[model samples]
Target: MLGIFVLAPILIGTIAYIIRDTWAKPLLFLFQFSYVAFAFSQFLSVKANGPIIWNTGGYTDGLALSLFADSLSIFMVLMTSFIYLAFLIFAVNADYFHSKFYFMFLVLEGLIMGLFLSSDLFNIFVFSEVSTVVVSILIMLNKEKQAIYDGMIYFFVNVIGSSFLLFGAGMIYRTFGLLDIRAVSAAMPMLEEPQAMILPYAMMIVTVSNKTAVMPLFSWLPKAHGTPSAPPVISAVLSGLYIKSGVYLFIRFNQMFAPVIDMQSFFFWVGFFTSVMGVIMALGQRDIKLFLAYSTVSQVGLIVVGLSMGSNVAYWGAVYHIFNHALFKSTLFLTSGLIEKEYKTRNIHEIRGLFRRMPWVGAATAFAVLGITGAPFFNGSISKYMIANGTKDAGITLLLNIINLGTILSYVKYSAMLFGKSREEQPGKPERIAAATAFVLGVISLFTGLFGEFLTEFFFGIELQVDTAEYIKKSLVYVFMLVAGVAFYKGLLKRDRILERIGTTELTFNGIITVMTGYFITILVFLSSVL
Candidate 1:
């Protein structure tokens, strides 16, 4: 059954590609929906019966290939399914939905599912590499000159990352005589020389950090996510779902190596710096897609910080934020694509009067902006509050607030497109299905916050106690930040020369690789010192 979840999509997508008919898309969509339903049922069964472990060779010993689905993996599977479903629905109206595009997209989706479900370290590496190739093809589908360059950069960087991952997996296999993550984790405590594991840990984590778009290794993200040639749905999936695969691996490997090394503090600080730098870069972007892309970098940083905080509440908050970010950010990207399609421009400064011209898209965009900026009664606010509540230090709490302020300020510039006089008119009516999908996502973003406590408990079996007084206090803080963000944008950011330079500047392919190398070495040194 676990194999079915991973293999069914690949098979169906391949068949669809072979058919190459006009009806291939609808047929593919039906197959995908059926697979998602089956996967959800499996998820529920796992939830009721506990983890399901499948040994493909039917061997009970360590030599067999293993796939395991626990609460966490199944949850991710469900999230991936829903996001892909939304993307598919939007793609129904897209012009680029050819047989080859769906083929690569489904292949990528299946590989990601395999990544989440596979318990073997080698399997994870294999899945990661295959997904990287498929995603690069999708990135370069339009064959634009800049897109080709961005796609090559993305491809080579990930190829390097995957090679590191494979090396790390080989080390673990040699050390433990087993490649299964569960088996290795069980054996971790038995090792007499835990220090021997440090090099493997560093290699694997540095690679995962690059995947998660951590600072210094994040240069590929904005390029890939904001590539004008890629479809909006592709951008949404890349930002919302693809990146979380890296974060999932980070969490998995960190826990797997907990007996040998604990570097939560290092990751927590890295996440803080990433969040700060991400938003700073976001504040300088004039292109709407690039702005959202950098915001994703910042949000991923916040998620990392929450997970590394050593508090269960904060950890769960980070998990919830992952889901919330997918909802809001995907909506923002999809809606931005619609706006760009209508106006034939990507510049935020040139586009105007979305509210008057396309009210539904405008409303959805507004909700997404509010959700992302941590507005009171929005989904981001709840997750941010939970993460903040987990912090013991005043200084860290203040830093969290500053990150929130930065988020608000960046969106203040973004929200400009929602209002003002129109510069051009759209030619045709918008696609109803796409508009409806975005609006539904926007509604989910709002309702997720309104019912945060119940949903958190339902999803993760973690009870959250809401403090009304604290909520009120945080609301006031949000209001203050809202006012302050507006002032900062109007008075300072609008006139800042340095920010413009930082935003407009991008690293070359070699520069990105250099940063990744530097980050890997830094991690090695830091871990050596701490351990």
Candidate 2:
């Protein structure tokens, strides 16, 4: 089941390449939908926590490709399957892209599935690198020079990271004489591990951090996602579902090294700073896609904190939030794309009277905004509350509070752009394409709200007990935060002083100061603890 689920996209992609026509699109869509069905079937039949691994060549123990289906992998597979479906459907309305769009996208989809399912260390690295490359190729579908530039940067960064990962794998193999994840875990305790052996770990961290767009390493993300030719929903998936995979690997690797290092303080503060940094960047963007792209960086910081906090509840909450982010963010980006299709703009400043002409898109944007901002009765609200509760238990209340403040401020900026009065009134009929897309997304968002608890239980292997009282309390907190953030945005963002700081391009000296200061502070604290 796991191998089929992972390999289906590759097979489909190959077929699509051999037979490119109108039929190819529907075929790709079918394969995506089939994967979704396979996931649900597996969920019904498989045990909650047990892993099923399929190894080729008659199940040889030493050297064969293996795919593992666990709850975590299944959850990601299911999420991507649905998202790809939406991406393809939404893409149908666009102009002719390269034939390789279908091929590369499906192959990338397969690679992600394989990455999620792989139980082998080297294989995980292999599949991850492949997926990264495929994504770069997909970006080239736009044929923009910026796409090529960003793609090259992405390629270099991932290659460097992969080298570190390979070195790390080599070190682990030398120490334990094993390459499989399960075997390595079982053998890790007895290995003669040097503290400096973590250089590979550090490199791998840098690699995944860049991929996931953590604050300092995230300069490429806005450029890549803000590209005009890429589908907005695809951008959303890049931000929402795909980035979480790196975080997932980080968490998985962290567990292996738990005995040697404690990352609680480090991750808490890293997440805190990254969260604040991301939302601040988000606030200054005039383009809607760029704003959402920065918002993803911020939300990712929160997910990282949740994973690093390491409480069972926190871990599961983070995973739940991954699912929610994928759905709502993609929906929001798709809505933005639909608006751009109709109005031919993503500039928030020029995107006035959208509610008058494209009310459904506006409304869908409203729901998605509400969802990501953690409003009550939506999927984002539940996971965020869970994350907050989990963080409190993990002694990260202060960091979480700062993130909350930043998130509220970011969303307030977004909403103000939408609801603000238009400078010019233009009356026009609603676009069916925009309306249809928005309606679908709005329904999905509402569905997510109603069955939020069910999703958590199904995806995370935890029972969600609905607490009406807690929900009410959290609702009030959200309301208050929203109000406070709006006030701050109006008072501070409207001011020339703060706006100048936000809009100004920092120079080489400033960039160096930031990186050195942040990196030094991080290492100093770690060294202090060790000494």
Candidate 3:
């Protein structure tokens, strides 16, 4: 059953490509629905029973190749299934929704599920490497010069980054004499010294941090995610669902080393600096896709902070936020495609009056904006509230508020397109299916928030009480931040030369590889000193 999650998509995708006819799309949709239903059943089963583990070759759990599905990993698989379907529908009428695209796209889905469910360290590295190649292919699907350059850079940098993971996995296997993460974790208590794992931890954290796009090493994100020639759904998946794999690995890897290590404080700062840098760079983007890409860097920072908080509430909040980000970011990216085509431009300042020209798309964009900005009753607010409530430290709360403020500020620029009069005389006819798919997902962004508590319970199987008074207080703070963000954006961020240069500045491929090596060494040095 676990392998089915990884195998079914690849098989179905191949069948879709081979059909490559009118029947192909119908078959794809039918298979997609079945996948989602099966995923949901697995989620429910994980809740009702316990984890489902499979060992290939009928070997013992610790020694054999392993597939394990618990509450968290299965839920991720289910989330990917749902969004991959939505993305499929979103691209149904697209020019690039041909057989080859579906082949690679569905295969990417399976690879991501493999990342979520695989318990073997070596298998995780294999999945990551393959997914990197698949993503590069998707990026280059446009076959334009820019896409090729960006895709190549993406391929090389990620391949280099993944080597660190391979090394880390080998080191761990050598030290613990186990390849299974569960097996390694269970053996941790017997380890003679914490220092034995520091090198492995540092090596692994480098790959995860690079994949997660934290500061100094985040230069590849806008280039890869905001590639001018890639399909919008590619951007959506990369930003929305695919990047979460790094985050998922971060959680799992930490657990593997948990018995002998604790580095929450170090990572919390890493997340904070990343958050600030993300917002600062985002504020100056003229390209819509680039702006959104930088925003993702910032949002990932927040998720990292929550995960690093060492509080269960904050950790789950980060996980739930991952799901929320998928909804809103996917909606934004999908709608950006529609808006870009209708306006025939990608410049944020050049595009005007989306609300007047494309009412449905504008509405959907507005809903996502509300959700991402953490407006009351939107899904982002609930998770953010939980992250804030994770600690009583006033300074931490203040820093969180500041990050939220920066998020609000960056989005203020994005939301501007939703208002004003169109420069075009007449609007183009809306793509009905695309518009409907994006709109439906946008609406879910709101509904998910309205039922945030219940969804958290069901998705995570944990009942968490939200203090009404505290929530109200946080809502008030959000309102204030909204107002402040608007004022700050209009007053200073609108024309800041420093920010403009920062946003445009990015590392070349060689530079990115250099930074990756430097980051790995820094992590090793830091761990050596502390551990």
Candidate 4:
């Protein structure tokens, strides 16, 4: 059953690719629906029984290929299935839909699912490399203008990251003579020299950081996610779900190496700065997609902060945020795509009267903005509050608030498009499926906020008793931040030349790789010093 979750998609995708007929797409869609149903069943099974483990060739030793599905892995699989299903629906009505596109898309989906489920280190490396190739190809699929250059940069940089992962895996294999994660965990505490694992841990984590788009290594994210030529659905998936794979691995590896390394504080500070820089960069973006792209960097940073806090409450909050971010961010990106189509431009300044012309898209966009900015009744506010509750450090709490303020400011700039008069009425009716998808996601975003505690308990089996009075107090703080964000945007960001320059500046491929190298070296040195 566990193997079916990973292999079925690949098998169907390969068949679709070979067929290359119009019917192939419909067949692929059926397979996607089947997979979602299968994932839901797996989730229930995991809840009722224990974790599911399957070893190929009936070999139980570390050398055999294995798939393990626990609550976390199954939950992630379910989330990916939902998002991919939405993407598939959107693609059905999109100009980019074709047999070839569906084939690659399905292949990528299988690889991602496998990455989440694999129990062996080597299997993870293999899945990551294949997924990297598929994503680069998808990124360059349209081949418009700099698409080739963008794809090459994404490919080369991630290949370098993959090399680091391979080296780290080798180190682990040499140290323990085993490759299974469970086996490594069992062997870790009995090792004579715990400090010997630091180098491998650091190497692997830095590579994961690049995938998660933390700090300097993040240069590739905006380029990949906000590429003008790529399909908007691709951007939505990449920002909303794909990068979470890196985060998931970050958590997994930290658990595996816990006996030898304690780097929670290191990631916490890095995430803090990444959040700060992400929002600052977002403030300068004129393109709506690019603005959302940088905002994702900021959100991922916040998620990292939550996960690194070493508190179970914060860990769950981080997990919930990953889910919430996927919902709201996907809504934003899908709606942005609709707006771009209707307005004939991606510039925030040039686009206006969204409400007057395309009310559905405007309303969906507004809901997403409110959710992301952590408005009192929105989903983001709940997760943000939970994450805040996990920390006792004043400085860390203050930094969280600052990040929240920056978030509000960026979205305030974004919401301007919802107002003002339209230059012309949009021609033709909007795509019904796209509009329906966005609206449904928007509604879920609101409902998740309204019933956050219940949903959290339902999904994660953690009871969260809400303190209404305390929440009301936090709501007041949110209002203050909203007002401050408005003032800051109007008074400073509106006329700031330096910020404009910073936002508009683009880095070349070489410059990006240089930053990644510096990031790797800095993490290595910091870990060496601390250890």
Please report the candidate that would top TM-score against the real structure: 3
The backbone clash count of each candidate, in order, is 0, 0, 0, 0
Q: Which candidate is the best by lDDT?
A: 3
| Candidate 1 least-lDDT 10 residues | 421-430
Tens digit per residue, CA lDDT, model 1, 147-202:
99889989999999888898999999889899888889889999998888988998
RMSD to the true structure for each prediction, in A, is: 1.4, 3.1, 1.0, 1.5
CA lDDT of each candidate? 0.89, 0.72, 0.91, 0.87
Q: List the residue pairs that clash in candidate 2.
A: none
**Could you tell me every candidate's TM-score relative to the true structure?**
0.98, 0.91, 0.99, 0.97
- Give the Å error, residue 187, model 2: 1.2
Report the C-alpha lDDT of model 4 over 149-200, residue by residue, as the tens digit.
7888889989998888899999999998999998898899998877788778
Instruction: Compare candidates 3 and 4 on TM-score and give the better one.
Output: 3
lDDT of 2 by residue, 1-531 (tens): 577877788888889888888888778778777777887777655554376778877667545667767777777777778777777766665664336777787787888777777878788889888887887776666778867766665565566556767777877777767777766666656646446445545645655665677767676677667666776655766776677788777776776666565666677667767888888888777778888888888988888888877677777878888887887788777777776766677776677666766667777888888888888888778777777767444456766767877887877766754664555566444446545665676667767877888877766668877689878987897888888888878876745356436733432433533553364356445645573
- Please list the residue runs of candidate 3 whose C-alpha ends up more than 4 Å from where it truly belongs after superposition: none
